[model samples]
Target: MSLRKKIADSEAVLNWVARRIAGYARRVYRNTKWQRVGFEELDRLADAGEPVVVVLWHQRLVMSPFLYPLDKGRICTITSAARAGSMVGRVQHLLGMDTIAMSSHKRHVALSREVLAMTKQGVSIGIAADGPRGPERVLSTVPLIWARTTGKRVFCMTYSVKHGREASSWDRMLLPRVWGNEGVFLCKEWPHQVPRKATEEQTEELRLSLEVAMNDLTAEADRMVGRAPWEPRAK
Candidate 1:
Protein backbone atom coordinates (compact mmCIF):
# COMPACT_ATOMS: atom_id res chain seq x y z
CA MET A 1 0.00 0.00 0.00
CA SER A 2 3.08 2.25 0.34
CA LEU A 3 3.96 4.66 -2.53
CA ARG A 4 7.41 3.04 -3.02
CA LYS A 5 5.90 -0.48 -3.15
CA LYS A 6 3.32 0.62 -5.72
CA ILE A 7 6.00 2.16 -7.92
CA ALA A 8 8.09 -1.03 -7.71
CA ASP A 9 5.10 -3.13 -8.76
CA SER A 10 4.44 -0.88 -11.75
CA GLU A 11 8.09 -1.07 -12.79
CA ALA A 12 8.03 -4.84 -12.61
CA VAL A 13 4.97 -4.96 -14.86
CA LEU A 14 6.62 -2.62 -17.35
CA ASN A 15 9.78 -4.73 -17.42
CA TRP A 16 7.76 -7.89 -18.07
CA VAL A 17 5.96 -6.19 -20.95
CA ALA A 18 9.25 -5.00 -22.45
CA ARG A 19 10.71 -8.48 -22.27
CA ARG A 20 7.61 -9.96 -23.90
CA ILE A 21 7.86 -7.51 -26.77
CA ALA A 22 11.56 -8.23 -27.26
CA GLY A 23 10.98 -11.96 -27.24
CA TYR A 24 8.18 -11.59 -29.78
CA ALA A 25 10.43 -9.54 -32.04
CA ARG A 26 13.14 -12.17 -31.83
CA ARG A 27 10.67 -14.92 -32.73
CA VAL A 28 9.49 -12.93 -35.73
CA TYR A 29 12.92 -11.99 -37.00
CA ARG A 30 14.40 -15.44 -36.62
CA ASN A 31 11.57 -17.25 -38.34
CA THR A 32 13.89 -17.78 -41.27
CA LYS A 33 15.12 -20.49 -43.55
CA TRP A 34 18.03 -21.92 -41.54
CA GLN A 35 20.90 -24.07 -42.72
CA ARG A 36 23.25 -25.69 -40.26
CA VAL A 37 26.82 -26.81 -40.82
CA GLY A 38 28.59 -29.00 -38.25
CA PHE A 39 25.56 -29.59 -36.06
CA GLU A 40 26.17 -33.32 -36.21
CA GLU A 41 29.50 -32.85 -34.50
CA LEU A 42 27.78 -30.98 -31.71
CA ASP A 43 25.26 -33.76 -31.41
CA ARG A 44 27.98 -36.38 -31.21
CA LEU A 45 29.75 -34.51 -28.44
CA ALA A 46 26.57 -34.08 -26.50
CA ASP A 47 25.64 -37.73 -26.97
CA ALA A 48 29.00 -38.71 -25.51
CA GLY A 49 28.31 -36.53 -22.46
CA GLU A 50 31.12 -34.16 -23.23
CA PRO A 51 31.01 -30.59 -21.99
CA VAL A 52 31.76 -27.71 -24.33
CA VAL A 53 32.27 -23.99 -24.15
CA VAL A 54 30.19 -22.47 -26.92
CA VAL A 55 31.88 -19.36 -28.25
CA LEU A 56 30.57 -16.73 -30.63
CA TRP A 57 31.04 -13.06 -31.42
CA HIS A 58 28.88 -10.51 -29.65
CA GLN A 59 27.37 -9.24 -32.90
CA ARG A 60 25.97 -12.68 -33.67
CA LEU A 61 24.01 -13.03 -30.44
CA VAL A 62 20.67 -12.42 -32.12
CA MET A 63 20.35 -15.82 -33.75
CA SER A 64 22.35 -17.87 -31.27
CA PRO A 65 19.39 -19.13 -29.27
CA PHE A 66 18.16 -20.93 -32.34
CA LEU A 67 21.53 -22.43 -33.26
CA TYR A 68 21.52 -25.24 -30.73
CA PRO A 69 18.86 -27.78 -29.91
CA LEU A 70 17.42 -27.21 -26.46
CA ASP A 71 17.26 -30.93 -25.80
CA LYS A 72 21.06 -31.05 -25.64
CA GLY A 73 21.19 -29.70 -22.08
CA ARG A 74 21.19 -26.44 -20.18
CA ILE A 75 23.60 -23.66 -21.23
CA CYS A 76 24.90 -21.07 -18.81
CA THR A 77 25.87 -17.55 -19.85
CA ILE A 78 26.99 -14.47 -17.99
CA THR A 79 25.12 -11.19 -17.88
CA SER A 80 25.68 -7.97 -15.97
CA ALA A 81 23.58 -6.58 -13.11
CA ALA A 82 22.21 -3.77 -15.23
CA ARG A 83 18.56 -3.46 -16.27
CA ALA A 84 19.45 -4.46 -19.82
CA GLY A 85 21.18 -7.52 -18.48
CA SER A 86 18.07 -8.44 -16.53
CA MET A 87 16.00 -8.21 -19.71
CA VAL A 88 18.53 -10.34 -21.54
CA GLY A 89 18.53 -12.89 -18.75
CA ARG A 90 14.76 -13.17 -18.97
CA VAL A 91 14.91 -13.56 -22.73
CA GLN A 92 17.58 -16.24 -22.43
CA HIS A 93 15.53 -18.06 -19.83
CA LEU A 94 12.65 -18.16 -22.25
CA LEU A 95 15.05 -19.79 -24.68
CA GLY A 96 15.93 -22.43 -22.03
CA MET A 97 19.22 -20.98 -20.79
CA ASP A 98 20.56 -20.13 -17.35
CA THR A 99 22.41 -16.86 -16.72
CA ILE A 100 24.94 -15.69 -14.16
CA ALA A 101 25.04 -12.00 -13.28
CA MET A 102 28.52 -10.51 -13.32
CA SER A 103 30.19 -7.40 -14.63
CA SER A 104 32.82 -7.83 -17.33
CA HIS A 105 34.67 -4.72 -16.13
CA LYS A 106 35.72 -6.41 -12.90
CA ARG A 107 37.43 -9.63 -11.95
CA HIS A 108 35.52 -12.67 -13.17
CA VAL A 109 36.69 -15.15 -10.60
CA ALA A 110 33.17 -15.83 -9.37
CA LEU A 111 31.77 -16.10 -12.85
CA SER A 112 34.50 -18.51 -13.83
CA ARG A 113 33.89 -20.61 -10.76
CA GLU A 114 30.18 -20.89 -11.46
CA VAL A 115 30.66 -21.66 -15.13
CA LEU A 116 33.28 -24.25 -14.36
CA ALA A 117 30.88 -25.92 -11.98
CA MET A 118 28.18 -25.97 -14.62
CA THR A 119 30.52 -27.54 -17.17
CA LYS A 120 31.57 -30.15 -14.69
CA GLN A 121 27.94 -31.15 -14.45
CA GLY A 122 27.82 -31.64 -18.23
CA VAL A 123 26.05 -28.37 -18.83
CA SER A 124 27.57 -26.39 -21.68
CA ILE A 125 28.40 -22.71 -21.27
CA GLY A 126 27.75 -20.14 -23.97
CA ILE A 127 29.87 -17.03 -24.18
CA ALA A 128 29.85 -14.00 -26.43
CA ALA A 129 33.62 -13.67 -26.66
CA ASP A 130 33.63 -9.90 -27.16
CA GLY A 131 30.53 -9.02 -25.24
CA PRO A 132 28.88 -7.05 -22.40
CA ARG A 133 30.71 -4.28 -24.27
CA GLY A 134 32.78 -5.01 -27.30
CA PRO A 135 35.45 -3.97 -29.69
CA GLU A 136 33.33 -6.24 -31.91
CA ARG A 137 34.71 -9.65 -32.74
CA VAL A 138 37.87 -9.15 -30.74
CA LEU A 139 38.52 -12.35 -28.82
CA SER A 140 38.45 -12.67 -25.08
CA THR A 141 40.27 -15.50 -23.30
CA VAL A 142 37.39 -16.41 -20.96
CA PRO A 143 36.17 -19.29 -23.07
CA LEU A 144 39.63 -20.72 -23.42
CA ILE A 145 40.16 -20.41 -19.70
CA TRP A 146 36.88 -22.22 -19.02
CA ALA A 147 37.79 -24.99 -21.42
CA ARG A 148 41.14 -25.43 -19.75
CA THR A 149 39.79 -25.39 -16.27
CA THR A 150 36.92 -27.74 -16.99
CA GLY A 151 38.71 -30.00 -19.45
CA LYS A 152 36.04 -29.16 -22.01
CA ARG A 153 36.33 -28.36 -25.70
CA VAL A 154 35.64 -24.92 -27.17
CA PHE A 155 33.08 -24.98 -29.98
CA CYS A 156 33.14 -21.81 -32.03
CA MET A 157 29.98 -21.02 -33.97
CA THR A 158 28.74 -18.08 -36.03
CA TYR A 159 25.89 -17.22 -38.33
CA SER A 160 24.92 -14.80 -41.08
CA VAL A 161 21.69 -13.82 -42.78
CA LYS A 162 21.17 -13.09 -46.48
CA HIS A 163 18.91 -10.18 -45.61
CA GLY A 164 19.15 -8.33 -42.32
CA ARG A 165 19.89 -5.00 -40.68
CA GLU A 166 22.84 -4.13 -38.50
CA ALA A 167 22.39 -1.98 -35.44
CA SER A 168 24.82 0.89 -35.08
CA SER A 169 25.76 -0.27 -31.62
CA TRP A 170 29.28 -0.92 -30.44
CA ASP A 171 29.10 -4.44 -31.79
CA ARG A 172 27.19 -3.58 -34.97
CA MET A 173 24.62 -6.09 -33.70
CA LEU A 174 23.00 -8.22 -36.34
CA LEU A 175 19.22 -8.08 -36.65
CA PRO A 176 17.77 -10.89 -38.68
CA ARG A 177 15.14 -10.41 -41.38
CA VAL A 178 12.15 -12.68 -41.25
CA TRP A 179 11.95 -15.26 -44.07
CA GLY A 180 15.56 -14.57 -45.11
CA ASN A 181 18.14 -17.27 -45.64
CA GLU A 182 20.34 -17.80 -42.61
CA GLY A 183 23.50 -19.89 -42.44
CA VAL A 184 25.28 -21.16 -39.35
CA PHE A 185 28.80 -22.52 -39.33
CA LEU A 186 30.34 -24.37 -36.43
CA CYS A 187 34.11 -24.71 -36.28
CA LYS A 188 35.93 -27.76 -35.07
CA GLU A 189 37.12 -27.74 -31.50
CA TRP A 190 40.30 -25.81 -30.82
CA PRO A 191 43.25 -28.20 -30.92
CA HIS A 192 45.44 -26.43 -28.42
CA GLN A 193 44.88 -26.49 -24.69
CA VAL A 194 45.94 -24.06 -22.01
CA PRO A 195 47.62 -25.73 -19.05
CA ARG A 196 46.69 -24.84 -15.51
CA LYS A 197 49.86 -22.79 -15.29
CA ALA A 198 49.46 -21.11 -18.65
CA THR A 199 51.58 -18.00 -19.01
CA GLU A 200 50.13 -14.67 -20.05
CA GLU A 201 51.85 -14.97 -23.42
CA GLN A 202 50.47 -18.46 -23.93
CA THR A 203 46.98 -17.26 -23.07
CA GLU A 204 47.32 -14.38 -25.49
CA GLU A 205 48.38 -16.79 -28.20
CA LEU A 206 45.31 -18.95 -27.58
CA ARG A 207 43.10 -15.85 -27.67
CA LEU A 208 44.51 -14.85 -31.06
CA SER A 209 43.95 -18.34 -32.42
CA LEU A 210 40.33 -18.32 -31.25
CA GLU A 211 39.79 -14.91 -32.80
CA VAL A 212 41.04 -16.10 -36.18
CA ALA A 213 39.04 -19.33 -36.07
CA MET A 214 35.81 -17.55 -35.08
CA ASN A 215 36.24 -14.88 -37.72
CA ASP A 216 36.93 -17.46 -40.39
CA LEU A 217 33.84 -19.46 -39.48
CA THR A 218 31.71 -16.32 -39.46
CA ALA A 219 33.02 -15.31 -42.87
CA GLU A 220 32.24 -18.77 -44.20
CA ALA A 221 28.71 -18.53 -42.83
CA ASP A 222 28.23 -15.20 -44.57
CA ARG A 223 29.49 -16.66 -47.81
CA MET A 224 27.08 -19.56 -47.46
CA VAL A 225 24.26 -17.03 -47.25
CA GLY A 226 25.60 -15.10 -50.26
CA ARG A 227 26.77 -12.21 -48.11
CA ALA A 228 30.18 -10.68 -47.77
CA PRO A 229 32.26 -10.88 -44.64
CA TRP A 230 31.46 -8.16 -42.14
CA GLU A 231 33.94 -5.32 -42.13
CA PRO A 232 34.16 -3.25 -39.00
CA ARG A 233 34.20 0.49 -39.32
CA ALA A 234 37.46 2.26 -38.63
CA LYS A 235 37.74 3.82 -35.20
Candidate 2:
Protein backbone atom coordinates (compact mmCIF):
# COMPACT_ATOMS: atom_id res chain seq x y z
CA MET A 1 0.00 0.00 0.00
CA SER A 2 1.16 3.56 -0.57
CA LEU A 3 2.24 5.78 2.35
CA ARG A 4 -0.63 8.08 1.47
CA LYS A 5 -3.13 5.23 1.81
CA LYS A 6 -1.56 4.10 5.10
CA ILE A 7 -1.68 7.64 6.45
CA ALA A 8 -5.28 7.99 5.37
CA ASP A 9 -6.14 4.76 7.23
CA SER A 10 -4.22 5.75 10.35
CA GLU A 11 -5.92 6.89 13.55
CA ALA A 12 -4.62 10.44 12.95
CA VAL A 13 -7.05 10.64 10.03
CA LEU A 14 -9.74 8.47 11.62
CA ASN A 15 -12.16 11.38 12.00
CA TRP A 16 -11.80 12.22 8.34
CA VAL A 17 -12.05 8.56 7.46
CA ALA A 18 -15.15 8.11 9.58
CA ARG A 19 -16.88 11.07 8.03
CA ARG A 20 -16.46 9.73 4.51
CA ILE A 21 -16.56 6.00 5.18
CA ALA A 22 -20.29 5.56 4.64
CA GLY A 23 -20.31 7.63 1.51
CA TYR A 24 -17.34 5.72 0.13
CA ALA A 25 -19.13 2.52 1.10
CA ARG A 26 -22.30 3.57 -0.72
CA ARG A 27 -20.26 4.69 -3.67
CA VAL A 28 -18.62 1.32 -3.81
CA TYR A 29 -21.96 -0.38 -3.34
CA ARG A 30 -23.36 1.55 -6.29
CA ASN A 31 -20.29 1.04 -8.40
CA THR A 32 -20.33 -2.75 -8.01
CA LYS A 33 -23.02 -4.92 -9.56
CA TRP A 34 -23.88 -6.92 -6.45
CA GLN A 35 -25.30 -10.39 -6.95
CA ARG A 36 -27.38 -11.61 -4.05
CA VAL A 37 -27.51 -15.38 -3.86
CA GLY A 38 -29.98 -17.17 -1.57
CA PHE A 39 -30.79 -14.21 0.66
CA GLU A 40 -34.56 -14.61 0.24
CA GLU A 41 -35.25 -16.40 3.54
CA LEU A 42 -32.91 -14.18 5.47
CA ASP A 43 -34.65 -11.14 4.03
CA ARG A 44 -37.95 -12.33 5.43
CA LEU A 45 -36.75 -11.85 9.04
CA ALA A 46 -37.29 -8.11 8.53
CA ASP A 47 -34.50 -7.29 11.03
CA ALA A 48 -37.35 -5.58 12.86
CA GLY A 49 -40.25 -8.03 13.06
CA GLU A 50 -38.13 -11.08 13.77
CA PRO A 51 -34.77 -9.95 15.06
CA VAL A 52 -31.81 -12.25 14.59
CA VAL A 53 -28.07 -12.19 15.00
CA VAL A 54 -26.05 -11.89 11.80
CA VAL A 55 -22.52 -13.27 11.97
CA LEU A 56 -20.00 -11.76 9.57
CA TRP A 57 -16.25 -11.81 9.17
CA HIS A 58 -14.28 -8.77 10.27
CA GLN A 59 -12.43 -8.64 6.96
CA ARG A 60 -15.52 -7.67 4.96
CA LEU A 61 -16.48 -4.72 7.15
CA VAL A 62 -16.29 -2.14 4.38
CA MET A 63 -19.55 -2.88 2.54
CA SER A 64 -21.40 -4.28 5.54
CA PRO A 65 -23.44 -1.14 6.04
CA PHE A 66 -25.55 -2.04 3.03
CA LEU A 67 -26.37 -5.58 4.16
CA TYR A 68 -29.76 -4.55 5.45
CA PRO A 69 -32.24 -1.96 4.28
CA LEU A 70 -31.58 1.62 5.26
CA ASP A 71 -35.17 2.85 5.40
CA LYS A 72 -36.96 -0.16 6.82
CA GLY A 73 -35.66 -2.42 9.53
CA ARG A 74 -33.78 -1.47 12.68
CA ILE A 75 -30.22 -2.81 12.67
CA CYS A 76 -27.62 -2.66 15.42
CA THR A 77 -23.98 -3.67 15.64
CA ILE A 78 -21.29 -3.67 18.27
CA THR A 79 -17.94 -1.95 17.99
CA SER A 80 -14.89 -1.77 20.20
CA ALA A 81 -14.47 1.23 22.48
CA ALA A 82 -11.02 1.92 21.06
CA ARG A 83 -10.29 4.94 18.87
CA ALA A 84 -10.57 3.01 15.61
CA GLY A 85 -13.80 1.48 16.82
CA SER A 86 -15.14 4.97 17.33
CA MET A 87 -14.65 5.46 13.61
CA VAL A 88 -16.46 2.23 12.87
CA GLY A 89 -19.39 3.24 15.07
CA ARG A 90 -19.48 6.62 13.37
CA VAL A 91 -19.58 5.02 9.96
CA GLN A 92 -22.46 2.80 11.03
CA HIS A 93 -24.25 5.86 12.37
CA LEU A 94 -23.79 7.62 9.08
CA LEU A 95 -25.34 4.58 7.44
CA GLY A 96 -28.28 4.71 9.90
CA MET A 97 -27.35 1.93 12.31
CA ASP A 98 -27.56 1.77 16.09
CA THR A 99 -24.28 0.83 17.79
CA ILE A 100 -23.15 -0.62 21.07
CA ALA A 101 -19.61 0.35 21.92
CA MET A 102 -17.71 -1.91 24.30
CA SER A 103 -14.10 -2.67 25.05
CA SER A 104 -13.16 -6.05 23.56
CA HIS A 105 -11.22 -7.08 26.65
CA LYS A 106 -14.05 -6.31 29.03
CA ARG A 107 -17.20 -7.18 27.08
CA HIS A 108 -19.35 -8.95 29.62
CA VAL A 109 -22.81 -9.50 31.08
CA ALA A 110 -23.74 -5.88 30.58
CA LEU A 111 -23.19 -6.15 26.87
CA SER A 112 -25.34 -9.25 26.70
CA ARG A 113 -28.15 -7.51 28.56
CA GLU A 114 -28.05 -4.60 26.16
CA VAL A 115 -28.09 -6.94 23.16
CA LEU A 116 -30.96 -8.89 24.63
CA ALA A 117 -32.95 -5.70 25.11
CA MET A 118 -32.28 -4.64 21.56
CA THR A 119 -33.29 -8.04 20.25
CA LYS A 120 -36.51 -7.84 22.22
CA GLN A 121 -37.19 -4.52 20.61
CA GLY A 122 -36.82 -6.14 17.20
CA VAL A 123 -33.45 -4.74 16.35
CA SER A 124 -31.35 -7.20 14.41
CA ILE A 125 -27.75 -7.28 15.58
CA GLY A 126 -24.69 -7.83 13.43
CA ILE A 127 -21.56 -9.31 14.99
CA ALA A 128 -18.18 -9.85 13.47
CA ALA A 129 -17.68 -13.42 14.66
CA ASP A 130 -13.90 -13.19 14.53
CA GLY A 131 -13.20 -9.65 15.56
CA PRO A 132 -11.81 -6.99 17.95
CA ARG A 133 -8.92 -9.42 18.04
CA GLY A 134 -8.84 -12.50 15.85
CA PRO A 135 -7.19 -15.72 15.01
CA GLU A 136 -8.47 -14.83 11.53
CA ARG A 137 -11.84 -16.56 10.79
CA VAL A 138 -11.56 -18.53 14.05
CA LEU A 139 -15.08 -18.17 15.35
CA SER A 140 -15.52 -16.51 18.71
CA THR A 141 -18.04 -17.99 21.16
CA VAL A 142 -19.64 -14.62 21.83
CA PRO A 143 -22.20 -14.91 19.05
CA LEU A 144 -23.00 -18.45 20.09
CA ILE A 145 -23.55 -17.29 23.65
CA TRP A 146 -25.83 -14.53 22.42
CA ALA A 147 -27.89 -16.99 20.37
CA ARG A 148 -28.30 -19.29 23.35
CA THR A 149 -29.14 -16.52 25.79
CA THR A 150 -31.37 -14.42 23.58
CA GLY A 151 -33.25 -17.22 21.86
CA LYS A 152 -32.48 -15.59 18.55
CA ARG A 153 -31.32 -17.41 15.45
CA VAL A 154 -27.82 -16.82 14.13
CA PHE A 155 -27.33 -16.14 10.41
CA CYS A 156 -24.03 -16.13 8.54
CA MET A 157 -23.47 -13.50 5.85
CA THR A 158 -20.56 -12.83 3.50
CA TYR A 159 -19.69 -10.97 0.31
CA SER A 160 -16.87 -10.96 -2.19
CA VAL A 161 -15.80 -8.44 -4.82
CA LYS A 162 -14.54 -9.47 -8.21
CA HIS A 163 -12.35 -6.34 -8.33
CA GLY A 164 -10.58 -5.49 -5.11
CA ARG A 165 -7.27 -5.52 -3.32
CA GLU A 166 -6.65 -7.77 -0.37
CA ALA A 167 -5.19 -5.82 2.52
CA SER A 168 -2.14 -7.19 4.33
CA SER A 169 -4.11 -7.04 7.56
CA TRP A 170 -4.39 -10.21 9.61
CA ASP A 171 -7.91 -10.81 8.29
CA ARG A 172 -7.02 -9.95 4.69
CA MET A 173 -9.55 -7.17 4.31
CA LEU A 174 -10.88 -6.53 0.81
CA LEU A 175 -10.55 -2.96 -0.45
CA PRO A 176 -12.84 -2.38 -3.41
CA ARG A 177 -12.09 -0.15 -6.35
CA VAL A 178 -14.20 2.92 -7.08
CA TRP A 179 -15.36 2.34 -10.66
CA GLY A 180 -16.81 -1.21 -11.08
CA ASN A 181 -16.21 -4.89 -11.86
CA GLU A 182 -17.78 -8.21 -13.03
CA GLY A 183 -19.76 -8.30 -9.76
CA VAL A 184 -19.98 -8.60 -6.01
CA PHE A 185 -21.48 -11.72 -4.38
CA LEU A 186 -23.55 -11.80 -1.20
CA CYS A 187 -25.69 -14.23 0.82
CA LYS A 188 -27.19 -14.57 4.29
CA GLU A 189 -29.47 -17.61 4.23
CA TRP A 190 -27.62 -19.87 6.63
CA PRO A 191 -29.19 -19.82 10.10
CA HIS A 192 -27.40 -21.60 12.95
CA GLN A 193 -27.08 -21.47 16.71
CA VAL A 194 -26.15 -23.19 19.97
CA PRO A 195 -29.04 -24.45 21.99
CA ARG A 196 -29.99 -22.89 25.28
CA LYS A 197 -29.51 -26.14 27.16
CA ALA A 198 -26.30 -26.99 25.36
CA THR A 199 -23.53 -28.48 27.42
CA GLU A 200 -19.99 -27.14 27.10
CA GLU A 201 -19.15 -29.84 24.60
CA GLN A 202 -22.36 -29.23 22.66
CA THR A 203 -21.61 -25.51 22.58
CA GLU A 204 -18.15 -26.19 21.24
CA GLU A 205 -19.61 -28.47 18.60
CA LEU A 206 -22.11 -25.80 17.61
CA ARG A 207 -19.38 -23.19 17.53
CA LEU A 208 -17.31 -25.21 15.08
CA SER A 209 -20.40 -25.90 13.02
CA LEU A 210 -21.25 -22.24 12.72
CA GLU A 211 -17.63 -21.45 11.92
CA VAL A 212 -17.49 -23.94 9.09
CA ALA A 213 -20.88 -22.79 7.85
CA MET A 214 -19.59 -19.23 7.56
CA ASN A 215 -16.45 -20.35 5.78
CA ASP A 216 -18.51 -22.43 3.38
CA LEU A 217 -20.90 -19.57 2.75
CA THR A 218 -18.01 -17.22 2.02
CA ALA A 219 -16.45 -19.69 -0.40
CA GLU A 220 -19.74 -20.01 -2.25
CA ALA A 221 -19.98 -16.23 -2.49
CA ASP A 222 -16.48 -16.04 -3.88
CA ARG A 223 -17.22 -18.66 -6.48
CA MET A 224 -20.33 -16.79 -7.55
CA VAL A 225 -18.29 -13.64 -8.03
CA GLY A 226 -15.74 -15.50 -10.22
CA ARG A 227 -13.06 -15.76 -7.58
CA ALA A 228 -11.53 -19.05 -6.55
CA PRO A 229 -12.84 -20.10 -3.17
CA TRP A 230 -9.95 -18.83 -1.06
CA GLU A 231 -8.72 -20.47 2.07
CA PRO A 232 -10.34 -19.30 5.30
CA ARG A 233 -7.57 -19.68 7.82
CA ALA A 234 -8.42 -20.43 11.43
CA LYS A 235 -5.02 -19.27 12.56
Q: Positional deviation of 141 in candidate 2, in angstroms? A: 0.3
Give me the displacement of residue 173 in model 1, in angstroms. Answer: 0.5
Tell me, by lDDT, which candidate is best.
2
In candidate 1, what are the lDDT values of residues 19-112, reduced to their tens digit? Answer: 7756764764467666677778787777776768888888887666666556866677776666656556667776677888777555677766
What TM-score does candidate 1 reach?
Answer: 0.85
Query: What value of lDDT does candidate 2 attain over all alpha carbons?
Result: 0.79
TM-score of each: 0.85, 0.87
Q: Residue-wise lDDT of candidate 2 within 61-128, one digit each (tens)?
A: 88887776545578898888876677878898888889999875665887888888898888988888
Top candidate (TM-score) = 2
- The per-residue C-alpha lDDT of model 1 at residue 122 equals 77
